[model samples]
Target: MLEATIPVKHKVGLHARPASLFVQTAAKFSSAIKVKNLSANGNFVDAKSIIMVLTLGVMKDHEIVIQTEGADADAALAALKSLIESNFGES
Candidate 1:
């Protein structure tokens, strides 16, 4: 498995449209992706599920740990990391 801790950079965090975009990005990968909100005490959820992701209650500057396993794990992690770092292109 590949993992990375990424900070949420979007002003509104991962909610609504941002969450939707995240789910979409996660789904593009064949790797199993999971996310844990470290700031929320480490509850992990499926990254491809919008409902599961929304439950994280992620907020701006909150740190999240992303894990990817299986084929294309590296690519998936890189893409997701870039998306978050890009602020979901919201700025």
Candidate 2:
């Protein structure tokens, strides 16, 4: 398993569009991806589920822990981390 701790850089946090993008990225991997909102009292949720992700109510600067386990765990974590670090390609 691979894990990464990252901050939500998007100005509006993981709302509809960003959450959709996140779910899409997570689904591309063979790994089982899970996310925990560290800033939200360590609540863990499925990374591939947009509904679950949205339930996190992640806000800007909130820290999240992403974990993946499977054949492509490293690649999956890299892509997801990049997406967040890029602010979901939004300014």
Candidate 3:
């Protein structure tokens, strides 16, 4: 498993649209992806689960914990980090 810390770049955080985009990106990978907030409740959320992400209610500057396990973990992490860094293309 590989893990990384990313801050929410979207002004409104991972809402419906951004969460949907995140789920779509995560689904493209063959690895198992999980997202969490260490500062929140410390529970991991399914990266491809829209409802789970929506429940997080992440906001800008919020730190997100990402984990992936699989052969393509590095690539998956890079792509996911880029996606989040781009504010889900809202930036």
Candidate 4:
């Protein structure tokens, strides 16, 4: 398994559209992905599920730990890291 801690920089964080985008990105990977909101001290949840991701209550500047396992773990981590680092493509 591969894991990385990433900070959410989007204005609204992981909610609504951002959470949807995050779930969408995770769904593209064949690997199993999980996310935990470090700042919130939350437990890990399915990254591919919009509802679970939303439950993390990830607000702006909150740190999250993403774990990926399986054939595409590396790619999955990189993709998710990129998404958060890029602020979910928001300006």
Candidate 4 overall lDDT versus native? 0.92
| Candidates by TM-score, descending order | 4, 1, 2, 3
Per-residue C-alpha lDDT of model 2 across residues 1-91, encoded as one tens digit per residue: 8889999988778887888999999999989999989888757799999989999989889999999999999999999999999899876
Worst 10 residues of 3 by lDDT: 37-46
The numbered model that scores best in TM-score is: 4
Q: Model 2 compared with the native: what TM-score? A: 0.95
Candidate 2 lDDT (Cα, 0 to 1): 0.91
TM-scores across all candidates?
Answer: 0.95, 0.95, 0.91, 0.96
Model 4 poorest ten-residue lDDT run: 82-91
Runs with alpha carbons beyond 4 Å of true place in candidate 4: none
Superior candidate under TM-score, 2 versus 4:
4
Better of 1 and 4 by TM-score: 4
| Model 4 residue 41 distance off true place after TM-score fit, in angstroms | 2.4
Tell me the deviation in Å of residue 18 in model 1.
Answer: 0.9
Assess the local accuracy of residue 74 in candidate 2 as a C-alpha lDDT between 0 and 100: 93
Candidate 4 lDDT, 34-85, residue by residue in tens: 9999998779999999888999999999999999999999999999899888
Residue pairs of candidate 4 with colliding backbone atoms: none
